[model samples]
Target: MPKVTCHNICDAIAAAPLPDGMHTKLIGIDGCGGSGKSTLARQLAQDIGARVIPTDDFAAWDCPLEWHDRFMAQVIGPFQANQPARYQRYDWHSRTLANWITVPAGGTVIIEGVSAIRQLFRPALAYKIYVETPRAIRLARGLARDGADAWPMWQGWMAEEDAYVAAELPAKQADLVIDGTQPLAAR
Candidate 1:
């Protein structure tokens, strides 16, 4: 059940039954910053041969959740139709759309990001996963990865995630809750 948060959540997801009438199993990895959403997504992708779509491709420092329209139009819509999808990847350093990426049709997909399991995505998802970690740990991990110079940006992103959580209730609505603090090998 979703309430049973644990490191072995990936195993649980693999064993769970998917909904019928879909071309692919759509999985979402959602969590606050440094909660290991992307890490879990990567692990799941490797485990299931799924393409991991990092929400970072669409995210920006000032507007963390602004990629909703592009995601819907590019990824979700095409996936639902059993058609390949393409997205213009956003370059973090340049702060611009740099390159394009493609997702093949009829394959498993793991979408990881702050709002990966936002309400709008529920209808298409086979499994809505929420990764939970302590705020302090999350912030530390984020800062470590993005560097200390990006501390303020991380804070702003966390604040945006906080608001989204309040409004969307992603954790409560998820099909699985993962203990992201755990090691991937153990998980």
Candidate 2:
């Protein structure tokens, strides 16, 4: 297992060359709740000038896994054909679908969330990163981030996510596993 601070990951990503011959490369970042998947994805995107497509932005709050068809139509289809892709955004406040988003071509596209690396999307990804953090620390972080009022629901959601991942075994299939508990050191 290779352990890295967050800054080190960013440094490594900045030094890496963009994939050859492809207008867009999809990177999947999957992790347990509060394991810092989004944070790392954002940093990587900033370092590499890549587009960050958060899976949360596409998913329904109550049913996150049901957006695979949307992802296929929006992201995968466009990148595969070397065309710009667009998809609707989920409005968390109104609990309704929002305006469309256009994903431009010719850079890395990071799809990040709990199930971003699911079996359905794995084949299309150029690289897949799984983030690991101790359960207790994750729960504490989640509780702090979401608040006590939302902790119960968050815990339930995590349980459901865990069950799904257990059946799918996403970690075993990932290209890299990142230790997310530690902060990224300044390089």
Candidate 3:
């Protein structure tokens, strides 16, 4: 229920006892747009020498939240079997699927994005992390990163995130709720 203080998330995860099911432990990093999920994922990946697969890789212009089934089948399925997980990466520039990515069996695999911690993927996750940042800060981060033209998209995403969160209390279910303003600094 409380937020993660000044601590290395990767350290916490690496030390936590993991349950057996998947050869690779999954960690979901989820939050609203510009809430620092990607930053946390990158830092955690580097900290524990793990790999990350963003839901953006599966984005197809349809509701981004609608990725649980496909992601579970394509990625989680293989990982659970101790085999490499494969996914077709979506290209935002071209608006098409560009290439297939192979994620080998490993210690930890991070899933990062708005709806990364969908209910379907929970059974395979070692832990779930939800980044919480204020709307003002998130909006500022979005404008700075995606430029002024992205406000419309960000607004729509925020609304979607709100509805999703309302329907599913992800934060309450999270193993660790992080303050996005605080970076997941590597030690």
Candidate 4:
């Protein structure tokens, strides 16, 4: 998808009525790899006093989809139960499990990553945001971030993401679509 320079994205978010503090709300931030989905999710969480749970922490370097069960068990289940939940973080460099992180209560949680808004988790999300960026730009960003050593892997990941999104229809299901290449307005 081509990146749109619409400043209205955050404006729309701001205009929406804030959810009551009584319930936990999950915000799924979905996009192609290195498309600024994480950045936007973090900023939005900070702006709205929400906590961010990055899906990158769950995905393995070689097998990103393998952590779905862990994600559901640790994060989603606890949040749905209205309790604090802890999840083991993936060590991307070591390609192993790392430290465990806890998800706290009382605020919206931003789940940010490529498959963060997958069909299995859609019902659990209070709102979904799709970050639309150009494929060329996304590929450039991914390669730059991951380095030349992982270029082929990155390409494969991109193809996998394309196939997943096509089958899942996350963009069509999204409550909001943001052009992540644009700068967010200063609060």
Candidate 5:
């Protein structure tokens, strides 16, 4: 895999040709939990004026990858029709659907999370990114953010993520694979 700076990734996105009959460019940033997918997504969004919609907003501790139908109906469907995407964010704190977030039509939009680049979203994506980080580092990050009490939950989640990775092979499907351990500085 070729190592690329965030700037290079942004440039590639900007230059990438959109598929026929598509109005908006969708980018998927996929990685395991605590793999710095959010960091990279934010940086790319800031650099390129793209909207960032994290899959975390939809996924909960129990439902890891089952929110695809809702995602397709709320976000992808609207964007595909050149309309704004309005979807409820699943607040992890309350473990329920929360406030509505709107993503305007056209231009670039990023969906970042564990299954952000799943088979369901592949056809609409103009660019795909997978963040590669060590399992030890990822677990450490998770423990730091979620606390030691959440260890069992984290373990289960990690298992689910591993199964997803094995089944999907997102890194192999990615147009660009990035180092999650390094900070992605914007140009």
Candidate 6:
């Protein structure tokens, strides 16, 4: 795999040809929990003037990866039609769909999180990136952010992520694989 550093990612994206008939450049950043997907998405969005639609906005403690349908209906549908998209974000604290967010069409939009690059969205994506991090490091990061009290829940979520990796092989399909162990700046 070729090295894709934060410094050069914008240049790389600019150089890659978009698929024919694609009006919007949809980029998917997929990784297990705490693998730095969100971090990369934010930085890349800033650099490229893109909007981010996190899968976490649709995910919950009970439903991890099954939120694809909601994403398809709310985001992809409108994006395909070259119109603005709106969706309710699932608040982790309230456990409800809170706050509607409207993302304008055109330019780049990043769909990021665990299972963000699932098969259903691949045909529309201009680029796919997967972040690979060790289980121990990811668990440590998750515990730190979500607190140790959510240990059991985190364990279950990690198991689901493992199953997704086994079945989907997202990394194998990625146009770029980022090493989560290294800081993007260092890369």
Could you give the C-alpha RMSD of every candidate to the true structure, in order shown?
2.5, 2.6, 2.3, 3.5, 1.4, 1.5
- Report every candidate's CA lDDT: 0.83, 0.79, 0.81, 0.78, 0.90, 0.89
Residue-level lDDT tens digits of model 5 in 1-187: 5557778898899998775577889999999999999888888898899999999998999888789999999998888788889999999999999999998888999999998999888888889999999999999999999999989989889999999999999999999888899987555
Comparing 4 and 5 by lDDT, which wins?
5
lDDT of 2 by residue, 104-159 (tens): 97677889988888898876777888888888888888888868887767767787
TM-score of each: 0.90, 0.86, 0.90, 0.86, 0.95, 0.95
Residue pair clashes in candidate 2: 6-184, 7-184
Which candidate order results from sorting by lDDT in descending order?
A: 5, 6, 1, 3, 2, 4
User: Residue 74 in model 5: shift from native, Å?
Assistant: 0.8
- Model 4 lDDT per residue over 1-187, tens place: 4333333444554454434432567788999898899788877776777788888998866776667888999988787777787998888888888998987864678899988989888777877889889998898888888888988788778878888888988888898877767876654
Supply the TM-score for candidate 5. 0.95
After superposition, the stretches of candidate 6 with alpha carbons farther than 4 Å from their true spots are: 1-3
Error (Å) of candidate 3 at residue 141 is 1.0
- Global Cα lDDT for candidate 4: 0.78
Q: Which stretches of candidate 4 lie over 4 Å from their true place?
A: 1-22
lDDT by residue for model 6 (1-187), tens: 5566776787777776666666788899999999999999999999889889999999999998889998999998788888787999999999999999999988999999999888888887888999999999999999999999989999889999999999999999998898998888724
Give the clash count for model 6: 0
- Note the clash tally of each candidate: 0, 2, 0, 0, 0, 0
Instruction: Find the 10 residues in a row with the least total lDDT in model 2.
Output: 12-21
